[model samples]
Target: MSGLDETLLDDTEATVRVRFVVNGRKVACEVAPRETLVDCLRNELELTGTHAGCEMGACGACLVQLDGRAVHSCLMYAVQADGARIDTIEGLTESGVIADLQAEFHRRNALQCGFCTPGMLVNAHELLSQVAEPNREEIRDALSGNYCRCTGYEAIVDAIDAVAKARCEGGGAT
Candidate 1:
Protein backbone atom coordinates (compact mmCIF):
# COMPACT_ATOMS: atom_id res chain seq x y z
CA MET A 1 0.00 0.00 0.00
CA SER A 2 1.07 3.58 -0.74
CA GLY A 3 4.81 3.79 -1.51
CA LEU A 4 5.65 0.61 0.44
CA ASP A 5 6.47 -2.50 -1.51
CA GLU A 6 4.24 -5.43 -0.55
CA THR A 7 6.50 -8.12 -1.94
CA LEU A 8 9.05 -7.52 0.77
CA LEU A 9 6.55 -8.66 3.37
CA ASP A 10 5.03 -11.52 1.48
CA ASP A 11 8.05 -13.77 1.24
CA THR A 12 7.45 -15.84 4.34
CA GLU A 13 8.39 -19.34 3.21
CA ALA A 14 10.66 -21.35 5.49
CA THR A 15 10.09 -18.67 8.04
CA VAL A 16 9.95 -18.75 11.78
CA ARG A 17 8.06 -16.49 14.15
CA VAL A 18 10.41 -14.42 16.21
CA ARG A 19 9.57 -12.20 19.15
CA PHE A 20 11.97 -9.70 20.58
CA VAL A 21 12.10 -6.28 22.13
CA VAL A 22 13.61 -3.69 19.85
CA ASN A 23 14.30 -0.09 20.78
CA GLY A 24 12.17 -0.61 23.88
CA ARG A 25 9.27 -1.83 21.82
CA LYS A 26 8.18 -5.43 21.55
CA VAL A 27 8.28 -6.64 17.98
CA ALA A 28 7.13 -9.96 16.56
CA CYS A 29 7.61 -10.88 12.94
CA GLU A 30 7.95 -13.83 10.63
CA VAL A 31 11.39 -14.01 9.12
CA ALA A 32 13.09 -16.51 6.87
CA PRO A 33 14.96 -19.27 8.68
CA ARG A 34 18.26 -17.98 7.35
CA GLU A 35 17.41 -14.33 7.82
CA THR A 36 20.04 -12.34 9.60
CA LEU A 37 19.26 -9.85 12.33
CA VAL A 38 20.56 -7.09 10.11
CA ASP A 39 18.32 -8.16 7.28
CA CYS A 40 15.34 -8.38 9.56
CA LEU A 41 15.97 -4.95 10.98
CA ARG A 42 16.56 -3.37 7.61
CA ASN A 43 13.97 -5.22 5.55
CA GLU A 44 11.18 -6.10 7.95
CA LEU A 45 11.30 -3.45 10.65
CA GLU A 46 12.88 -0.84 8.36
CA LEU A 47 15.58 -0.01 10.86
CA THR A 48 18.26 0.62 8.27
CA GLY A 49 20.55 2.46 10.65
CA THR A 50 22.33 -0.88 11.23
CA HIS A 51 24.42 -0.94 8.08
CA ALA A 52 25.20 -4.22 6.33
CA GLY A 53 28.86 -3.86 5.49
CA CYS A 54 31.05 -6.93 5.17
CA GLU A 55 28.11 -9.08 6.20
CA MET A 56 30.55 -11.77 7.29
CA GLY A 57 31.13 -9.74 10.47
CA ALA A 58 34.65 -8.57 9.59
CA CYS A 59 33.28 -5.04 9.20
CA GLY A 60 31.39 -3.61 12.11
CA ALA A 61 28.73 -1.77 10.16
CA CYS A 62 25.95 -4.05 11.33
CA LEU A 63 26.66 -3.66 15.00
CA VAL A 64 23.78 -3.46 17.49
CA GLN A 65 23.52 -3.80 21.21
CA LEU A 66 22.00 -7.05 22.33
CA ASP A 67 21.17 -7.03 26.01
CA GLY A 68 23.53 -4.09 26.55
CA ARG A 69 26.42 -5.74 24.74
CA ALA A 70 27.47 -4.82 21.23
CA VAL A 71 27.09 -7.63 18.71
CA HIS A 72 27.32 -7.86 14.95
CA SER A 73 23.79 -8.17 13.68
CA CYS A 74 25.02 -9.48 10.37
CA LEU A 75 26.52 -12.48 12.10
CA MET A 76 23.46 -13.35 14.16
CA TYR A 77 20.26 -14.80 12.87
CA ALA A 78 17.01 -13.05 13.65
CA VAL A 79 15.76 -16.17 15.38
CA GLN A 80 18.76 -16.16 17.66
CA ALA A 81 17.69 -12.75 18.91
CA ASP A 82 14.31 -14.02 19.96
CA GLY A 83 13.48 -13.29 23.58
CA ALA A 84 16.36 -10.80 23.70
CA ARG A 85 16.35 -7.07 24.09
CA ILE A 86 17.80 -5.32 21.08
CA ASP A 87 18.89 -1.73 20.73
CA THR A 88 19.87 0.00 17.54
CA ILE A 89 21.08 3.44 16.61
CA GLU A 90 17.50 4.68 16.69
CA GLY A 91 17.05 3.53 20.25
CA LEU A 92 20.31 5.04 21.46
CA THR A 93 19.60 8.33 19.71
CA GLU A 94 16.06 8.48 21.06
CA SER A 95 17.22 7.76 24.60
CA GLY A 96 19.55 10.77 24.53
CA VAL A 97 22.34 8.73 26.13
CA ILE A 98 24.60 9.33 23.12
CA ALA A 99 23.82 12.94 22.35
CA ASP A 100 27.17 14.11 23.55
CA LEU A 101 28.98 11.43 21.63
CA GLN A 102 27.11 12.34 18.47
CA ALA A 103 27.98 15.97 18.90
CA GLU A 104 31.64 15.15 19.44
CA PHE A 105 31.63 12.95 16.36
CA HIS A 106 30.10 15.73 14.33
CA ARG A 107 32.48 18.34 15.67
CA ARG A 108 35.53 16.16 15.15
CA ASN A 109 34.45 15.10 11.67
CA ALA A 110 34.66 11.46 12.72
CA LEU A 111 32.01 10.58 10.21
CA GLN A 112 32.52 10.95 6.49
CA CYS A 113 30.08 8.79 4.51
CA GLY A 114 28.17 7.91 7.71
CA PHE A 115 27.82 4.19 6.97
CA CYS A 116 29.78 3.15 10.02
CA THR A 117 28.57 5.90 12.32
CA PRO A 118 25.80 3.89 13.93
CA GLY A 119 27.96 0.89 14.73
CA MET A 120 30.80 3.11 15.82
CA LEU A 121 28.48 5.02 18.10
CA VAL A 122 27.06 1.82 19.53
CA ASN A 123 30.50 0.46 20.24
CA ALA A 124 31.64 3.78 21.62
CA HIS A 125 28.66 3.94 23.91
CA GLU A 126 29.58 0.52 25.24
CA LEU A 127 33.22 1.50 25.69
CA LEU A 128 32.48 4.83 27.36
CA SER A 129 29.92 3.28 29.60
CA GLN A 130 32.33 0.67 30.79
CA VAL A 131 35.52 2.74 30.97
CA ALA A 132 35.00 6.28 32.20
CA GLU A 133 38.41 7.28 30.90
CA PRO A 134 39.95 5.02 28.32
CA ASN A 135 43.39 5.71 26.91
CA ARG A 136 44.12 6.14 23.22
CA GLU A 137 45.13 2.51 22.86
CA GLU A 138 42.02 1.37 24.70
CA ILE A 139 39.82 3.45 22.48
CA ARG A 140 41.56 2.12 19.39
CA ASP A 141 41.27 -1.42 20.67
CA ALA A 142 37.61 -0.99 21.39
CA LEU A 143 36.96 0.29 17.90
CA SER A 144 39.34 -2.09 16.17
CA GLY A 145 36.51 -4.35 15.04
CA ASN A 146 34.89 -1.47 13.25
CA TYR A 147 36.47 -0.72 9.91
CA CYS A 148 36.25 2.76 8.45
CA ARG A 149 37.41 3.18 4.89
CA CYS A 150 37.25 6.94 5.13
CA THR A 151 38.68 9.32 7.76
CA GLY A 152 41.55 6.98 8.69
CA TYR A 153 40.13 6.60 12.24
CA GLU A 154 42.22 9.45 13.67
CA ALA A 155 39.22 11.76 13.90
CA ILE A 156 37.02 9.03 15.29
CA VAL A 157 39.54 8.26 18.01
CA ASP A 158 39.78 11.95 18.80
CA ALA A 159 36.01 12.29 19.05
CA ILE A 160 35.62 9.35 21.46
CA ASP A 161 38.53 10.53 23.57
CA ALA A 162 37.13 14.04 23.74
CA VAL A 163 33.74 12.82 24.85
CA ALA A 164 35.25 10.59 27.49
CA LYS A 165 37.34 13.43 28.86
CA ALA A 166 34.51 15.93 28.87
CA ARG A 167 32.19 13.52 30.62
CA CYS A 168 34.80 12.81 33.24
CA GLU A 169 35.25 16.57 33.74
CA GLY A 170 31.50 16.98 34.42
CA GLY A 171 30.63 18.54 31.04
CA GLY A 172 30.53 17.19 27.51
CA ALA A 173 29.05 17.63 23.98
CA THR A 174 25.48 17.24 25.03
Candidate 2:
Protein backbone atom coordinates (compact mmCIF):
# COMPACT_ATOMS: atom_id res chain seq x y z
CA MET A 1 0.00 0.00 0.00
CA SER A 2 1.08 3.58 -0.52
CA GLY A 3 2.40 5.64 2.39
CA LEU A 4 -0.69 7.88 2.53
CA ASP A 5 -3.00 4.87 2.32
CA GLU A 6 -1.26 3.24 5.26
CA THR A 7 -1.41 6.44 7.29
CA LEU A 8 -5.13 6.87 6.58
CA LEU A 9 -5.83 3.24 7.46
CA ASP A 10 -4.72 3.90 11.05
CA ASP A 11 -7.83 6.05 11.60
CA THR A 12 -10.32 3.66 10.06
CA GLU A 13 -11.63 2.66 13.45
CA ALA A 14 -12.21 6.22 14.58
CA THR A 15 -15.75 7.47 14.88
CA VAL A 16 -17.36 10.90 14.84
CA ARG A 17 -20.69 11.82 16.34
CA VAL A 18 -23.20 13.49 14.09
CA ARG A 19 -26.70 14.79 14.62
CA PHE A 20 -29.41 15.30 12.04
CA VAL A 21 -33.16 15.46 11.60
CA VAL A 22 -34.22 12.35 9.76
CA ASN A 23 -37.79 11.63 8.76
CA GLY A 24 -39.16 14.30 11.07
CA ARG A 25 -37.24 12.87 14.01
CA LYS A 26 -34.00 13.96 15.60
CA VAL A 27 -31.24 11.37 15.43
CA ALA A 28 -27.62 11.17 16.48
CA CYS A 29 -25.07 8.49 15.76
CA GLU A 30 -21.38 7.76 15.75
CA VAL A 31 -19.83 6.81 12.45
CA ALA A 32 -16.43 6.40 10.90
CA PRO A 33 -14.98 9.39 9.11
CA ARG A 34 -15.17 7.69 5.75
CA GLU A 35 -18.55 6.08 6.30
CA THR A 36 -20.91 6.94 3.54
CA LEU A 37 -24.35 8.34 4.38
CA VAL A 38 -25.98 5.33 2.74
CA ASP A 39 -24.15 3.01 5.14
CA CYS A 40 -25.05 5.14 8.11
CA LEU A 41 -28.69 5.35 7.10
CA ARG A 42 -29.01 1.63 6.45
CA ASN A 43 -26.79 0.32 9.22
CA GLU A 44 -26.99 2.85 12.02
CA LEU A 45 -30.37 4.47 11.39
CA GLU A 46 -32.00 1.30 10.01
CA LEU A 47 -33.47 3.23 7.11
CA THR A 48 -32.98 0.45 4.63
CA GLY A 49 -35.11 2.05 1.98
CA THR A 50 -32.03 4.00 0.95
CA HIS A 51 -30.17 1.31 -0.97
CA ALA A 52 -26.41 1.30 -1.31
CA GLY A 53 -26.19 0.55 -4.98
CA CYS A 54 -23.21 1.98 -6.89
CA GLU A 55 -21.43 3.48 -3.93
CA MET A 56 -19.74 5.90 -6.32
CA GLY A 57 -23.10 7.65 -6.90
CA ALA A 58 -23.52 6.55 -10.53
CA CYS A 59 -26.68 4.66 -9.60
CA GLY A 60 -29.41 6.62 -7.88
CA ALA A 61 -30.54 3.77 -5.66
CA CYS A 62 -29.13 5.64 -2.69
CA LEU A 63 -31.07 8.77 -3.46
CA VAL A 64 -32.60 10.65 -0.54
CA GLN A 65 -33.85 14.10 0.22
CA LEU A 66 -31.09 15.98 1.94
CA ASP A 67 -32.26 19.43 3.01
CA GLY A 68 -35.30 19.15 0.75
CA ARG A 69 -33.32 18.29 -2.38
CA ALA A 70 -32.63 14.92 -3.94
CA VAL A 71 -29.09 13.71 -3.27
CA HIS A 72 -27.13 10.53 -3.71
CA SER A 73 -26.46 9.33 -0.20
CA CYS A 74 -23.78 7.00 -1.46
CA LEU A 75 -21.78 10.01 -2.56
CA MET A 76 -21.95 11.83 0.80
CA TYR A 77 -20.21 11.08 4.05
CA ALA A 78 -22.36 10.88 7.15
CA VAL A 79 -20.32 13.54 8.87
CA GLN A 80 -20.90 15.97 6.03
CA ALA A 81 -24.61 15.89 6.74
CA ASP A 82 -24.24 16.55 10.46
CA GLY A 83 -26.94 19.19 10.58
CA ALA A 84 -29.00 18.43 7.51
CA ARG A 85 -32.56 17.23 7.23
CA ILE A 86 -32.73 13.89 5.46
CA ASP A 87 -35.88 12.20 4.23
CA THR A 88 -35.82 8.63 3.00
CA ILE A 89 -38.47 6.72 1.15
CA GLU A 90 -39.73 5.33 4.42
CA GLY A 91 -40.29 8.82 5.77
CA LEU A 92 -42.04 9.97 2.63
CA THR A 93 -44.23 6.92 2.67
CA GLU A 94 -45.18 7.40 6.28
CA SER A 95 -46.00 11.05 5.75
CA GLY A 96 -48.16 10.28 2.72
CA VAL A 97 -46.69 13.18 0.81
CA ILE A 98 -46.29 11.05 -2.27
CA ALA A 99 -49.39 8.95 -1.90
CA ASP A 100 -50.79 9.87 -5.28
CA LEU A 101 -47.51 9.22 -7.00
CA GLN A 102 -47.12 5.91 -5.24
CA ALA A 103 -50.64 4.90 -6.16
CA GLU A 104 -50.07 5.79 -9.79
CA PHE A 105 -46.80 3.90 -9.93
CA HIS A 106 -48.45 0.82 -8.47
CA ARG A 107 -51.43 1.09 -10.78
CA ARG A 108 -49.10 1.37 -13.75
CA ASN A 109 -46.88 -1.47 -12.56
CA ALA A 110 -43.84 0.73 -12.83
CA LEU A 111 -41.76 -1.61 -10.73
CA GLN A 112 -40.80 -5.29 -10.80
CA CYS A 113 -38.02 -6.29 -8.40
CA GLY A 114 -38.72 -3.15 -6.32
CA PHE A 115 -35.06 -2.54 -5.55
CA CYS A 116 -34.98 0.72 -7.48
CA THR A 117 -38.45 1.85 -6.50
CA PRO A 118 -37.39 3.80 -3.44
CA GLY A 119 -34.88 5.94 -5.23
CA MET A 120 -37.23 6.45 -8.15
CA LEU A 121 -39.94 7.59 -5.77
CA VAL A 122 -37.59 9.98 -4.00
CA ASN A 123 -36.48 11.43 -7.31
CA ALA A 124 -40.03 11.69 -8.54
CA HIS A 125 -41.11 13.41 -5.35
CA GLU A 126 -38.34 15.93 -5.70
CA LEU A 127 -39.15 16.53 -9.35
CA LEU A 128 -42.80 17.14 -8.69
CA SER A 129 -41.97 19.41 -5.81
CA GLN A 130 -40.00 21.70 -8.10
CA VAL A 131 -42.12 21.38 -11.21
CA ALA A 132 -45.80 21.01 -10.46
CA GLU A 133 -46.49 19.78 -13.96
CA PRO A 134 -43.77 18.07 -15.95
CA ASN A 135 -44.13 16.65 -19.41
CA ARG A 136 -43.24 13.08 -20.25
CA GLU A 137 -39.93 14.18 -21.74
CA GLU A 138 -39.20 16.22 -18.66
CA ILE A 139 -40.03 13.32 -16.39
CA ARG A 140 -37.77 11.04 -18.44
CA ASP A 141 -35.00 13.62 -18.29
CA ALA A 142 -35.34 13.99 -14.55
CA LEU A 143 -35.19 10.22 -14.14
CA SER A 144 -32.12 9.88 -16.31
CA GLY A 145 -29.89 9.45 -13.32
CA ASN A 146 -31.97 6.67 -11.76
CA TYR A 147 -31.49 3.24 -13.34
CA CYS A 148 -34.21 0.59 -13.22
CA ARG A 149 -33.27 -2.84 -14.49
CA CYS A 150 -36.69 -4.40 -14.08
CA THR A 151 -38.83 -2.05 -16.12
CA GLY A 152 -38.28 -0.30 -19.45
CA TYR A 153 -39.02 3.12 -17.78
CA GLU A 154 -42.03 3.69 -20.03
CA ALA A 155 -44.42 2.84 -17.25
CA ILE A 156 -42.52 4.96 -14.78
CA VAL A 157 -42.69 7.99 -17.03
CA ASP A 158 -46.36 7.45 -17.66
CA ALA A 159 -47.04 7.21 -13.96
CA ILE A 160 -45.26 10.45 -13.23
CA ASP A 161 -47.14 12.20 -16.01
CA ALA A 162 -50.43 10.93 -14.73
CA VAL A 163 -49.63 12.07 -11.22
CA ALA A 164 -48.72 15.52 -12.48
CA LYS A 165 -52.00 15.82 -14.29
CA ALA A 166 -53.90 14.55 -11.31
CA ARG A 167 -52.20 17.00 -8.99
CA CYS A 168 -53.02 19.90 -11.29
CA GLU A 169 -56.61 18.84 -11.49
CA GLY A 170 -56.79 18.46 -7.74
CA GLY A 171 -56.12 22.18 -7.35
CA GLY A 172 -52.36 21.76 -6.98
CA ALA A 173 -52.62 19.71 -3.82
CA THR A 174 -49.49 17.60 -3.44
Off by over 4 Å in 2: 1-12, 171-174
TM-score of each: 0.91, 0.91
| lDDT score, candidate 2 | 0.91
Off by over 4 Å in 1: 1-13
Poorest 10 consecutive residues by lDDT, candidate 2:
1-10
When summed lDDT is taken over every stretch of 10 residues in candidate 1, the lowest stretch is 5-14
lDDT of 2 by residue, 33-126 (tens): 8899999999999989899888887779999999999999999899999999999999999999998888888889999998889999999999
Q: Clashing residue pairs, candidate 1? A: none
* Clash count, candidate 1: 0
Residue 80, model 1: Cα distance from true site in angstroms: 0.6
